[model samples]
Target: MQGKAGFWNLSNKLTLFRIGVIPVVALLLLSPGRAPNLVAAALFLVAAITDTLDGYLARRRGTVTPLGKLLDPMADKLLLVTALIFLIPLGRVPTWAVAVIVARELAITTLRGIAASRGVIIAASWLGKVKNLLQLAAANLLILHHPYFSIDPHRLGTYVLYLALFFTVWSGLDYLWRYSRL
Candidate 1:
């Protein structure tokens, strides 16, 4: 049985699974037709669910490892960034909003790297987590990109993306401000 200190704990496996799903999700998103879009959205939703589950499992099971710490956020960025970029070509998401979100993600990731190098750990704040959740919601809805059950996924996704942008900027600025003070 894998112990809490083991590298291949269930949580880390889920994180790896999320990363592995990225390419397939990207392919589905790029494929033409509503069927492909729906599949991509479903896959993305699964990935998003794993995102939450991995963290919770890691914390609850005490199997949190350095690999999990590093890859969890990377998986999120890769999935979200890939989806948003593809959505741009599909005319589902605004290029500027994607740009802003991507910029913030890259900046914060860079900031975290710098902090790590200096023996500092910049943990994910609540605002940052909320930003990620909003981004995931937007990406899923935008990938679906169609009306269903009286809800316009595209329109709702746009609104959620806007909320995501606000949190992205806020959390990023918060990180920078804290880092600057250190």
Candidate 2:
């Protein structure tokens, strides 16, 4: 039991670490000049890896906490939004795409806050999960500038972004409708 508790504690600490790294990764990505883009991309990749590992460890170890629940999504949103915002002006991503994604994130976050305040916990929908995956892929591709082993990174990123946007809109409306009915 002591060992289990220790493991769980470590898992929670890792989750916190993942949340804390987002800003540093964002700042690295935001730095001027192309030389650091690769470094920024690597940092972003590390941050993304931490995101996955933390969640997996939490579930596997049964270490989920209210703080984890809140911080996980919040960190994800911050990282993705910061990446989109920084990349837009760099000409690496489209402004409209970032706008749509940001709007969706904001709407869903607001709805989640409302639901939490009412003592209702909303599980992430399948569509929402897919949207997240696509968004992550898009961010990664955009950050790397889409180097191709015969595939166009920009076009693929654009396609994934659109898919993410579609799901984001759908999921947002679904949450809103569900909340209204409740």
Candidate 3:
């Protein structure tokens, strides 16, 4: 396990793989064809799955390096933000919602940086975890953009995005409040 403390861990490689997929997913998303969109959705799903997998591996292996801590969140931001940015021109998502989510992410990251510099650790709250799950669900639903029987996935995705936005703000505030106490 002590050997796992270095940067050359399996979990770190998975995190890097997630980052590498971001551009492929983005470029594939921009292809002017339905097949490419479907492919993009599939790639995005794989990348999203890696998020959970990497974290699980890191914790279970006790190989959570500082680099993993940085790269993990960076990979998450790049994947989701890239999807949202590319989807904007396609009119598949609300720009204001995207803006709110991005803003919250930036704010929270800045807060984390400040906390880390001050030797204060503020772990993620339950609300933040739920927000991430909802964001992934929303991104998948929007990417699929297919109607399932009586349900319009696009509409449901929009609602999910709104809920994610609410939690993003709520969790950001919670983090800020928690940091203030420390």
Tell me, by lDDT, which candidate is best: 1
TM-score of 2: 0.83
In the range 1-182, model 2's lDDT, one tens digit per residue, is: 12346434665676667667677766767677555666767777777777778778777877767667667777778878888888887787789888888887887777778887889887888888888888888887777674647876667887888888888888878888887744
Winner on TM-score (2 vs 3): 3
Candidate 1 residue pairs that clash: none
Q: How would you order the candidates by TM-score, starting with the best?
A: 1, 3, 2
- Tell me the tens digit of each residue's lDDT in model 3 across 66-165: 8888899999998999899888888889898889889989988988888888897768789999999999888877876766678887899899988988
The candidate that wins on TM-score is 1
* Lowest lDDT block of 10, candidate 3: 1-10
TM-score of each: 0.92, 0.83, 0.91
lDDT of candidate 1 over 1-182, digit per residue (tens): 33456998889999999999889988998788889889989989999999999998998888888778879988988989998998898888889998999888888888888888899999889999899899999999999997889999999999999999999999999999989855
- 1 against 2, candidate with superior TM-score: 1
Task: Give me the runs in candidate 3 sitting further than 4 Å from their true place.
Answer: 148-151
RMSD of each: 2.0, 3.0, 1.9
